[model samples]
Target: MTKLMKAVVVPAVKAAWEVRQRPVPEPGPGEVLVRVHACGICGTDLWMAHGVLSFREFPLLMGHEGVGEVVALGAGVTERKIGDRVGLPMMQKRCGACGFCREEHPDSFVTAGNCAGPTLTGVNVDGALAEYAVAGVGGTVLLPNGISYEDAAPTVCAGYTTWAGIRRADARPGARVAVVGLGGIGHFAIQFARAAGYHVIAVTRPGKHELARELGAADVVTDGAVLKEIGGADVVLHTSSSHAAAIDAMTGLRPWGKLVLMGLSEDEMILPALSLTTHSHQIIGSAHNGLEYLAEALDIVARGQVRPMIELFPLERADEAYRKVADGEVRFKAVITL
Candidate 1:
């Protein structure tokens, strides 16, 4: 008999979701079947649900940050066993033949002709909101025994994204790093920046000062004025959705500083002419980290170097979790447990 599992499915654009049965997927070659323990809801999922992002199609299963146990393996899968805990990241298997992968370069995260392209899991395919999901074996990371599924789920996406930004900035110890926005990615940026030996300055709205400080920020400022008061930052991790806020964050960067943009904004970001030419400032956008980088991210979390604050909701309450995330009322991140 064919097995089935419950899943949260988006039937149409801006429509109500249905908790229905979906077939238990079998792993293909170079893939593995995972019994999902928890899946974190992301801002991209919210955008996909509401039809904001143009890449999404109707009748989609939305979730990317998944933590589970490998229950079955497909042909040629030797690295994973049936009971190992692993993370189902948004990135899939990488084609080993690509020049980017052949060089073992960290920055060559190719989406096309590799592992399911850049969309990867949850964007255009079946995702981990279900009880069981199939993922390419290459991108999944085995979790340490000390880390729980709930804790590891958010790090797969939120933590990795922020860590990628920090890596792109190439910050050194004692460098001043400013984190703009106090959402999920922002919180992780603050912690990762601090763990990397940089002084973390959190720039957020007025109400988030205490929470920012609690997350290892050396200083908390409400606006750009205070950022100017403390000289300037060597790097700025911009995770806010507002274009104006992102534009304002550039002023905080010192000469030759990097501003890494991790958030998705609909408005066009207009930059001043002299900012880049005179100061040699860089505006880099980072997304979709590769599996090699994700493994490093997991190591940091497994070692207790950083922690992801999350609120749990059962699979049946997935709608409520989506609503909470969309409303921007969530304290940090929200995870759905099976």
Candidate 2:
């Protein structure tokens, strides 16, 4: 009993996406059909479209982040039912039986698409740009007060990235924290740093200094070197993927400071070997987090501590939204509404 629904499809790599009517998917055992409320235009999505990343097949329904309502429930699912507002993040499902899952290594992401899950969704699965999507019950997050589905949508990825950055820092009260690139990840990083009780310094592109300051940077500086001049901090989180920015950020650290790379960077990163070989600095690549951090992110947003900036667009207008994100026309995050 497949119903008809509208979805965005990329028929091939490096191909333009087109809107198509797809059959509304039914939930299998342990699955649920979500009526997408909003889907965010992420950097990874842009990269995938541009061939910076590729896997599986094209002509696939692709969406990784969205806020939706649980319109149908599969067998064995009891906690959620029809009309439950929820979020489906990038990690649709991780293998609970994997060693990584056992060790609770947040980096051990074993998704079904990597397994046998619907690769036709977003990036190999039918994603949120569609009127309806099928997702595992495990990865769906129920939205709480203080977050509209529109606002909560970006947090599915952006918020989690910032949370992972903060966790990597082992941030404590009064620690000096610097966040580079105040875009989606950067904006949330500042708020997370504040919540962690750190002295927040924002580093962004020269064009975003004013925006950075407004977001709670004690001050915003385009020059990362000035970080060392001010004696630096215990943690510097990199949310921008620019290689030059990463290099400059390394030099800004105080001795033994931590640099957590959290953003999407397609560019091959080159760092000064001396920084790692000579100094006792901690440099960690912050990957997307597990359910633990996802819950934490939801909690923060529910409590109104971390708010994701989002713009809404009809799902049909996703290409326009993508162009805006790529062209830097969107000030914060842009979401496609179904």
Candidate 3:
């Protein structure tokens, strides 16, 4: 008989989450079976739950920011071994024959929107909101030691995306880096920017100023125009799910500065051509970017340079956790612990 494990599943679109028993999946070729210790609930998971994302497969098992130890390895898998701690990010597998994958440009797979490959974890296929999950070897990252499963779980997606945004900014030393939306991703942006030697400025709504400062933000402001009055930002990392917020944050970017957008908004964002060209500003869209970036993000967290603030929920209370995440009640990130 196949082993059974408890998993959080959605039977239909916008349905309430149910913790049900699912057969533990076996690892296929070039894959590893991870006994999941923790998984973070991301905005993408919430979007998928509501059928906001393009993929609409039913009975969704939604979780991408997962971390655990490799319990078994499939045939031809040598890079990962049993007992190795690892993280499963959003992009599980890409078509190796595609131009993006052929060139090892994982970033393009997301930005160019041309990936002809397996669907994303938690988006189309069953994900890690369970006792076990399988991940392609190429898409998994070995988690560094010294970081708990809870802390490392959020780094798989939230930390990785924010770190990629910071890298996309490529700001000079001591530059003013402003982070928009002090949520899960934005909080990591502030810490990573500070670690990268940039002066961090957090742009967020009221009541979050103190939290921003606590996360290494040198300054905190309620509006983007306030940043302009404070000499402008050399780089702005936009992590809000609101395109309007991104537009407002762009106002704070100095001439020749770059604005890195790592958020997803349902509505379209309008950019003024004249203002964009006149300012000589560049807009970069970043996602998980690469496994290398994920490794770096985990390493940073492991080294104590960055810390993840997460609320933990047991497997039985997964529904409550999902509700809190959907309701925006999680202070930073919510991680389900097995």
Candidate 4:
């Protein structure tokens, strides 16, 4: 018998979504069917729905972050059993025969980005907006102790993004780091930097000063105005769509320092190349992270070092959630429960 489950579907661009019934997916070869608990709304979801990003097909089941339990495993899958708690992340799934997959170094992420989310899966493939989802066993993370679905959801994206930027910075112990745009990624950045022994200076508009401090920022400032006061930082991580801010991140870095840009929004990014060249600092843009760094980041969360702040809503309230996110009213991240 075919099982029909509720799914949040985006039927078209610039149109309201419909909650329709989708047949529960069967686990294919090397795949597992999971009963999804929570899936967070990401910035990419917002952009794709509103025509800000136009690379995806419509009528999409758009979500990447999911925490759930395994219900069934497909052929050739014997490692994990039914009812195992795990997290399904949005990552690249490269074919093992590809050059990228074969070159999985410690510095590189997992070899599974080819079929990943954002640009690929969720946007391209059916994602976790439904009550049940199917994910590959290769890129999934089995959860550690005491990690809840709501909490673990954000780590799949926001946490990994922060980890990528921080690691790319190669921040030394006791060094000062600045996190620009204190939203989902920014909140995690402050916590990760503080826990990693860096003095975190969180930069946002004035409206977020108190919230920034509450998230463990050593200092908070209005974007670019008060931000310049803390000159010559060891590293600056940009999680904003602002093109000018991308340039500022580079100039803010100390000589030989690092500027990491994690947010690649639709806005055209224009940077002053001469200034970047003169500083001798490097500006690097990182896309998504892999399992090894994600596992280490999860360890940090398990040890109570880093946490994500989120606003929750049920699956039925997705439109309202979208409004709040589109208006920038969401404090950190927003998630729709199934």
Candidate 5:
């Protein structure tokens, strides 16, 4: 008998989300079957649902940041075993023959943003918005023992992205680091930078001041000009989706400072040529740099050095959770508990 499991399914672009029964997917070669315990809803998932990012097909199962347990293994799989805890990331598979993959450093594939052939879970393929999902063995990361499924879900993407941005900045100890945007990613950036022994400053709207402080930000500013008024930052992590905000935040960079961009903006970012050239400023774009970074993010959370603020919803209330996330009503990240 084919086993059936509950799944959140989008019938078409801009269609109403449905919680329907789907057959438990079997792991293929080099794949493992995961019984999803928690899945984090991301802005990218919203984009795909709203057709902002046109997927090749509809009726999609969308969720990239998912943590669960391995229940079954497919042929030729030795690295993972049943009952092992794991998390599935967005970058599920990469073409090893591509130039980006051939780079000397694994992080280069992320910096280049072009992996010739890539299989993005929850984007181009079926994802973990279901009771059970399948993932390639190479794409799954072992979840540390201390962190819960809900907390570890966001770490795979949100936490990983911001941590990668911080690593890309490569700030010195005691250096001032300003994080622009107080959303899911920005919030994580503040904690990660603070844990790394940097002076963390948060740049966000007036509403998030208290939360920012609670998250270990030394100072919270409304914008880049305010950030500049105080001592400028040696590294600026841009995690907002507004290109204008990124351009504004550049003014807060100290001489020879690094500005790392982790946000996805539809608008083209325009920088002042004179300012950039004269200051010798370096602008970097970062994403999930490597699986090692994901592991590190999880480790920090497991050690209690960082915590991800999240709102939880049962799988049955998946639609309500989606609505809250789309309307920006959730305080921070939203996780669907199974």
Candidate 6:
């Protein structure tokens, strides 16, 4: 017999969310059924709801950052079992046949390299806004025993994305990392860089210095003055959604330094030719987490090296939660709890 569950559904772009009863999804081969405890409200959710990013399927279920306990397992799934806590991040599933999934060594990083096809949970298909959600076994990670569902929810996407940027920068001990923007992603970036032994320099609009410092940032600066004080930074994790802010961050990077853009923007950045050619600076764009990266993030949270700050909203108040995130009123991240 098919089981039914209540889920938040959007009939169309710019439509009001409605609570609808949908048939509980059964796990297919290589997948697992998760009884969702919490799901996060992200900027991407807003973009999808507002029709900014065109993955435009109507009557959609949206939520990529989800944490839950496994309730059932599909055939051939030996990695996890019922009652295990798991996380479903945005990069939900990848084809093992792709170059990104095939590597010569296990230590090599997994990334969405040049491959065009991948299954995204919220954007491409149904996601975790429901009482039950499905995730690929390979893409799911077991949450740390110490982290609660509310804290673990945002880490699936918001936390992993920033951690990926910091890992790409390869910041060494004492190297300076200037984190631009102090939103959800930036908050985690600051802590992850610090945990990686980098001296974090947080940059945000004028009033966010204290908040940045509270997140374990070694120093806080409102603008590019951080460049002048330290002579330059070894790496810059640019998480600001503004195009101008993303481009300006390049000025703070020392010669051969890395600038990782973790923000979503549609604007074009006009870079000076001499600036790139002379300094040998690198600009890297990142999204979605690899299996190893997600596991590493969970481990970091487990060890108390970093923690995500989140506001909880009841599942039925998903609309209010989305509005709060859209209005920039959420302190850090917002989670829909069951």
Poorest 10 consecutive residues by lDDT, candidate 1:
107-116
Q: Residue by residue across 46-145, what tens digits does model 1's lDDT show?
A: 8888988745568999788999999999999999999999998776655556555565544324453243334367876789999998988875789876
Instruction: Give TM per candidate.
Output: 0.92, 0.90, 0.95, 0.90, 0.96, 0.92
lDDT of 2 at 247: 69
Every candidate's lDDT = 0.83, 0.76, 0.85, 0.76, 0.89, 0.82
> Candidate 2's residue-wise lDDT over 222-267, tens digit each?
7678877776767888888675686687788877788898877767
- Off by more than 4 A, model 6: 95-117
Per-residue alpha-carbon lDDT of candidate 5 for residues 213-236, written as tens digits (9 for 90 to 100): 999999999887888999889999
C-alpha RMSD for every candidate:
2.5, 2.7, 1.8, 2.8, 1.8, 2.5
Rate residue 245 of model 2 by lDDT.
86
Q: Which 10 successive residues of model 6 have the least lDDT summed? A: 104-113
Superposing every Cα of model 4 onto the true structure, what RMSD results? Answer: 2.8
Off by over 4 Å in 4: 54-56, 97-120, 223-228, 249-251
* The 10-residue segment with the lowest total lDDT in model 3: 105-114
Candidate 4's residue-wise lDDT over 19-65, tens digit each?
Answer: 89999999898888888888888888887898777665787788888
Residue-wise C-alpha lDDT for candidate 3, range 225-329, written one tens digit per residue: 898988889888888878888788778889998888887778799985776899998988778666777888889999999998899999899889989988889
Model 3 C-alpha lDDT versus the unseen true structure: 0.85
Top candidate when judged by TM-score against the true structure: 5
Whole-model lDDT, model 4? 0.76
Superposed model 1: Cα runs more than 4 Å off:
54-56, 94-119
**lDDT of candidate 6 at residue 331, scale 0 to 100:** 82
lDDT at 58 for candidate 2? 71
Q: Between prediction 2 and prediction 5, which has the larger TM-score? A: 5
Index of the highest-lDDT prediction: 5
